[model samples]
Target: MIGIRSVVFDVGETLLDDTREWMAWADWLGVPSHTMSALVGAVVAQGRDNADALRLIRPGLDVAAERRAREAAGRGEQISEADLYPDVRPALAELRRRGLWVGIAGNQTARAAELLRALALPVDAVATSGEWSVAKPAPEFFARLIEWAPGAPEEIVYVGDHPANDIHPAKVAGLRAVLLRRGPLGYLAAEDPAATAAADWRVDSLADLPGLLSPR
Candidate 1:
């Protein structure tokens, strides 16, 4: 394996806690938060994509319009810093201090990049699907990270919470993958040996990351 010189991350539950965002979606869809949670869980249990689950919940919904509305609302409302996980800043600082170039690449609305900037995350670069014109699990999305980071794909590590979105795609793109277990899909991935085995490293929290990626 090539030595790692850079690291990239998925934005959602990887760096930020998306519980409130999902709950907001539940409320906007007129469903109870628990009901929405159950549906998301069921979707994962069956090894189905979350998009399929959203379709099952509300077929024919105009997602793009809804996203636009959400972004507009976000612009007016201040997103709390508490939405970020406690370990994010320290872990990122440790990685950067160790000379690893850090970046963020994820599936998010156009506003997410602005939000991250507003939140003052200490990443070197940030790219969202909205900006890149492609989303994760897509070769283009992972490919963009290579363009943004300082090293070759094999010399980079991509870390995130989702098995399919973060780990699998990064591996397919020729980068090492590390699964951070804290998102909605993380539990399902953790229980599936095939998913866990696909990653080069699996840690319960970002706090475990810096040491795992430390130079040997």
Candidate 2:
């Protein structure tokens, strides 16, 4: 029960819904949307990396170049404000109103920051794995997030939907972890009796977040 001072969020499926983006990627890969969807589910079920799942769809695909092509065609990889959860803005606003710094830290691609910035979400900081040179489930990434927060790890709460990447690693980094029930891995984590207990907090939606993190 460390007094919480800041909240860091995972971008995809937590704050922003990427279902359309995934579907778009499926189209770009010349695969059926259902097929891509199933692959995503399988990846989560097997505890596999998402990149591996994409490679299964299109081996030797140049992911970066593909993204650039999409952008050039006006189908940028960034999530729009329309894709964001209904609860996201209010929750973030509440946190800032309560004097808590807010940020987004996730294992997103290079354009993540640009996309998030486009949404004009109320946050103090935004960062992606590509920018940090490290991805989640890694101590170094959390270290960078802590530095970005400019807050003591004990006083920060990392909110995300991934059990392995967000909850466990943030806990190991000495930040309180809050499991948000949205995204591919969220239900998967709940199905595991042990994994469900790993988080310091759990909420069904970001709307429930403000009350949970009120200074104790």
Candidate 3:
């Protein structure tokens, strides 16, 4: 196997827990927290987009428009160091210490990119789909990611929780993929024979990554 020279991460549910992000949406939508959670779970199981949960609660709702309105109301999104997974800092720091280029790329808003940078994670780069003008599951997005990557596609490992968005696409892009079974979508994906089979490796925690990528 080719030695891994870089490790890139997906944002939601991978590095960040995102519990508060969804709960804040529940507050803005005036929906009960349990109801919001259930809807999100439903969408995840159904392989629906994350915004589908909101559309189920409010049909014809423009997610972006509502986000602007929410910000105007002083109920905007916020992410911080506290939102990070317990293993995030240590994992990224370890990877970098091992002389691996570390980066974070995911389908998120510009504000999310700013918040992530503010967290001061030991990453070489941080980018979002919103900033890239493309998103996962699209060939163009991976093209852009590869453009931003430090090494050849074969030497970069893309780590993420979602199978469709992270695992399959990165593999298709010629980069190795590591499936992290966490989050609602992640656990659901862990049940899939195909998803596990497609990944270069399947792991439950980011902490396992350093050892897995370490040279034998």
Candidate 4:
């Protein structure tokens, strides 16, 4: 197996637990959790075409949908940057300790810096949708990552919970892809056999990351 040298992560579901933010949105919208769950299920049932899924969920929301959801809640409940993810600092630290270059690629707005500071994950570079004006599953974001890291594509592994956005495009971009199976979005991997097949590897927790990338 080719040894992995650099690891890039998808922020929302892969490293950050945005459940609180989602639930908060549901409460604000006066939509029940089950209703949102059903909507998400309906979207996933459409399979790997994320563009189709987004159309069904909330077309206007687009890449900034999560942030828009939080804003729509009207509770003055802004998402704290630090409360974004669980156990991220240690994981990033461990990767660095193992001598791997770390970076992040995801869809986000200007609030990305706040979110990163909140998670406290040590990332050498970041490519956000707001900055690029494009989202993942498109090669542009990953291409930006390559420019940012300037590392060999084969040595970079992209880890994310989304099949269409993260896993598929990383492979298309000539980087290895790892699916993170511990977040809300992880169910797609479980429900869709085809998605599971596309992933180079699957991890249940961020803590397992170090071992997965460690030299054999």
Task: Give the TM-scores of the predictions, in the order they appear.
Answer: 0.90, 0.93, 0.97, 0.80
Candidate rank order under TM-score: 3, 2, 1, 4
Please, what is the whole-model Cα lDDT of each candidate in the order they appear? Answer: 0.80, 0.85, 0.91, 0.71
RMSD of each: 2.3, 1.6, 1.2, 3.6
Q: Provide the lDDT at 163 for model 4.
A: 81
Candidate 3 structure quality by residue, lDDT tens digits, 19-76: 8989999999999999999999999899999899999999999999999998899988
The numbered model that scores best in lDDT is 3
The lowest-lDDT stretch of 10 consecutive residues in candidate 1 is: 70-79
lDDT of 1 by residue, 1-216 (tens): 336788898888788887787787787678889988888778877868765655777898777777667667763222468888899999988888888888888888667777777776777888889888999889988877888888888889998888878888889999999887787677668887977999999999887878778542
The clash count of every prediction, one per candidate, is 0, 0, 0, 2
Candidate that scores best on TM-score: 3
- What clash count does candidate 1 reach? 0
* TM-score of model 4 vs. true structure: 0.80
Model 1: colliding residue pairs: none
Question: Can you rank all candidates by lDDT, best first?
Answer: 3, 2, 1, 4
RMSD of 3: 1.2
Poorest stretch of ten by lDDT in candidate 4: 48-57
Q: Name the runs in model 1 displaced over 4 angstroms.
A: 71-79
Q: How does model 2 fare in lDDT?
A: 0.85
Question: Model 4: C-alpha RMSD to truth?
Answer: 3.6
Q: Give the alpha carbon lDDT tens digit for every residue of 36-139 in model 4.
A: 65665565566544334334455565534654656566543344645556667788888888888888778766567455645556777666787778777778
- What's model 2's lDDT at 61? 77
TM-score of model 3 relative to the true fold? 0.97
